[model samples]
Target: MRNMILAVIGLLLLGCSGGQSSNSTMTVSGVAATGAAVSGTIFLKDSAGHELSMATTDGTFSFDVSALKPPFMLKASWGGKTMYSFAAAAGTANITPLTQMIVAAAASSTDLDAAYQAPSPTTFSTIAANLPAATANLRNSLKPLLASYGADMDPISGKFSANGSGMDGLLDHVAVTSVSGTVSITDRSSGATLFSATASPALANSVSAMNWANDSAAVAQDPDLKVSEAGDGLAVWWSYTGTGYGASVIQARWLNSEQSATQISTATGFAMMPKVAIDGNGNAVVVWMQSDNQLNNVWVNRYVAGSGWGSPKKLTSAVSSATGPSGVPSIAIDAAGNAVIMWNQSDAAVSSHFDVYTSQYSVANNAWSTPAMLSTGTNSAYGYKVVANNSGTAAVIYNQFQRTDGRGGNGDASDIWVATGTTAGGFATRTKVSSSANPIYGQGSLAIDPAGDILAAWIQNNNSGYFDVWASRQPAGGSWEAPKTVANSVTGECYSPEVALDAHGNAFATWEQQLDTEGRQYVAASHYSAASGVWDAPAEISENIGNTYDQHIAVDPSGNATLVWYQIESAAVTVRSAQYLQSSGWGISQLIATMGAAYDGYTVFPVPRVAVNSSGKSIIIWGTGSM
Candidate 1:
């Protein structure tokens, strides 16, 4: 089927000023379907998305429109219907009476409200309030396009009507960079096109093209288990290489349980390892590394509650001697939707010329600060893991290897360091997390409680021809607790530690270990009691049948948890899972699926990610294969 190209029909035009001025002026005009006089408010907005002027519409609308600059946007809306269009200012800009009809006919107020509440991955809501009932932290950051709305009557038809232009806002935000872009509306189900247009680069990345679905909720998916405090939804992000494009593009998809997934990646490039941070409201911030024709740079995209995803903004400039290609990005969002993204890039100042760099997202300014170096005087740093709590403070922990100061036990040893940040003050100086100079292996994981307390897990060299999982805890605004062994000394070659903090302040830690007794690898877990400040004995969770690898766990608000992993023994690989009840310990491990032919004789590695909400709803995703 051919894609829908909505033809925006126009009527008449009007303006307050008869002549031109310092800036270009655009006048928008509209008329009732019946050719009768109607009333509604018209708003004039600046290029920065700030409201400039508003007036009553009497079958026509007009404004100075000078602040909006060239390629201006005009909107005419009333009740549940709004029609908006973009054009250059040679003369008057014409608009349709009902460019977008939310309801067939405004028979009742409830019908109008329902149209306003419907969700569309391509469309955005006009209201700017924080929808606590839907999700406390969910919000549409687009400033209101209208100052207010009122009730009016048709002069000729004598019918009551909603007297306000329906246009909520436009992508008139201040441009982060002057790159031209396109705006497109797509079908979440099939990636089919609905409507699209070329626009200033700022507008293209700031809004998603959308059309409403015929349902109570908007069409979307929650594959990442990022349940919306505003409602039930999930979100996930990834990057895939393209054949013809010659560059990889970052991808994001979100949906409710009943809806199909919506893809939010608008551009293609050499993007990889996309990371996400969803707030309590299901609003998300996605960050990834993309290589232009030249070098890799860090870019970020944001989803406004009710509105959908916005444009991607570059966080780093071209790679200079001062900085190299940005990669291995990680991000965390606070309850308020504020976010922080960090990555390791080449810096001339660092000893190895590669150091940890970070940028903080400001909701007030709707922009990211220039990338700043967080690791200084360190020989080399990488493997950054970051997490933010409700209080807006974030903890970043990464490995600093081959130090010039010789603090590490071995000259080549590496240690984990922690950095903290707030909206007011960016990341503080690095704090050594691991005590010894021994090498820390893999990426470190950090989790923060509501009170700002933190728990971290990582693999460290035991120095006795073996490796073990170590743990650390920090009280709110206090010094770190001495690192302690979280694993049983039952074997060697233990690593890949992951940590999760439940609502009750309990910290759950899981890791992979080689079993000498069984001559195989197994998964082990332990629980930490916040009240007693003690850790329970480690328990083996995987069967001895095969090599247990890539374990993932997510706990609901009730403290119930689900763990997923893949086991490879011989020719066939099996995906297995188990449940952990608060009162009863782990349930029987169950078979999720079997995969052998899927590999097609090629070597395969799987790392599953899991997320669960309070009601036991879980979303599990993995690469190569999924359960």
Candidate 2:
């Protein structure tokens, strides 16, 4: 009887132990997102580099952690980037870019892979202890965004869905990137920075919002944004589809002390490609191509210092109801508010041929002069770019097709030509600047210095059938230098060169270079030092991931420059930029805008434009199809 009773007690103890084991099976669950649902595998890992649980998720995930340990790391991989989250107790942990930022801040390091591969009990404890503070710091940094999106719940441990609401909405409008132990938060729509500093506990307390320029809205493509040399004024213009007119119209915004977007073009057909320039005295000149049902004409508008945008003025005439049009307008303004405008207009007498034309804006009279024919070429000429110096000297460059040059028309082979003039439209004799054997020199960009020196950059096909970047320098009151190749890749083509010159005559040029026959292009830049009188070897300014194009560069009086471009990689399109300092060389490229996944196929890759002031203050603007 005693042996039987002892056996019964042992059985009762075993039953109780099994019941406790069944009750202690804990499961961790949450959502994984990066604007769009992370439709990938989510892994739950421990501090010991052990994968505790793995599950495929459409964003929401659950991990059975009954047999796992504490201090877990949740990772979601997508878009070739890994996002992470930390869970001390494993209740709910959402894997996201922001959560990874918080984890990085708590650990005082951005090398998350290193930490994840080699974490100790002490390291895990330290991260757990600092998680709250890090969370608060990230929240503070994103206060405005959180408030705007109404995301009051905790990002890591919150019960949120990846359905474009709450935390998902916040994620849609911001881009969080970690580099060199620092975290940067930028507005996704505008690329306006919100916070950039070391991922530490003091981040939110020491940093204020850098997104004051956010308008919470977007414009159409081909927007031009410029800043004054004094850094006190800003002007932006773009062409957008009008509601009542059922056609595209040009609109502008001037910010000195107050501003709002005002439509400058009253076109019934379409007004497009609005380019703007702001002078030192807070004055601005905007020019665009407006259609009058039969022919497209160039129009101009001026914004006075104290007043708003003046009425739109037509600079070119729609001579006849013929199909010939005047378009591709470019503008520049001098320090004294003098302006120069350039465009290509069809020669009424010559069919199917276009000629370059120029018009000047007088600050004294606040009126644009009559369009003057600058290119006397009987051959077709187009792709005009213009720039103005502080002394009111303007420079223009274009490409003119030759009738037959034995070499090869290759479907309209052209030569690059340049000319200089005054703000009063009196241009000097046109000079052919490019002497390349390949007659197809195009994509010309022009820049002028305070002393009236001009730099022209273009691309011409080499004998190998690959396009290469070529640039020439015309010294103040001197002849044009022989065009030199600045960038030549062995297997790919380079095109769309943009050049900018500072007051000291230093020139910076950037262009898009093809990576493969698959149509992948990367941004490459070369610096031309006036002191050295040589173009530096070209450097790749962007990653070789996408097709980059529409690159535009601007320089201030102090030799500081800002270059902007847009890249399309897969279904994602991004606006990116790089800064050039005379003292430090070119800085690393940065993200200016990241179009959200909601409009993946419908995304509009706007031609990103940037302007910088002498103080290095810059404002970049681009258009979008949707928010």
User: Candidate 1 overall Cα lDDT vs. reference?
Assistant: 0.55
Model 2 Cα lDDT, one tens digit per residue, 140-173: 5565457667786678877654456677678777
Which stretches of candidate 1 lie above 4 Å from their native place?
Answer: 1-225, 230-233, 239-241, 257-263, 318-321, 348-352, 405-411, 488-490, 569-571, 600-602, 614-616, 625-627
Q: Write the per-residue lDDT of candidate 1 for residues 1-627, one digit (tens) a residue.
A: 011112222322234246434443344332322123324544433334444434443444455544454333444456654444323342333333222111111111112223333422122222211112111111121111111111122111122222222221111111111111222333333332222212211111122112112121111111223545533434454434445543445555553323344445556666656777777666788887777666678888888877877888777873355565776788887877788888988654544546778788887787788777787735677778788876798889888875575133334677788887774368765678787756667458888867788888788777675777888898887888999878746466886788888777788888788877668888888988889988898888987778888787776655667677778857666656766767567765555545535532135544445565544444444445233
Q: Which parts of model 2 are misplaced by more than 4 Å?
A: 1-218, 230-235, 238-246, 255-259, 318-323, 404-410, 517-519, 598-603, 625-627
> What is the clash tally of candidate 2?
1
Best by lDDT: 2
For candidate 1, give the lDDT of residue 627: 38
Best by TM-score: 2
CA lDDT, every prediction? 0.55, 0.71
Error of 2 at 145 (Å): 10
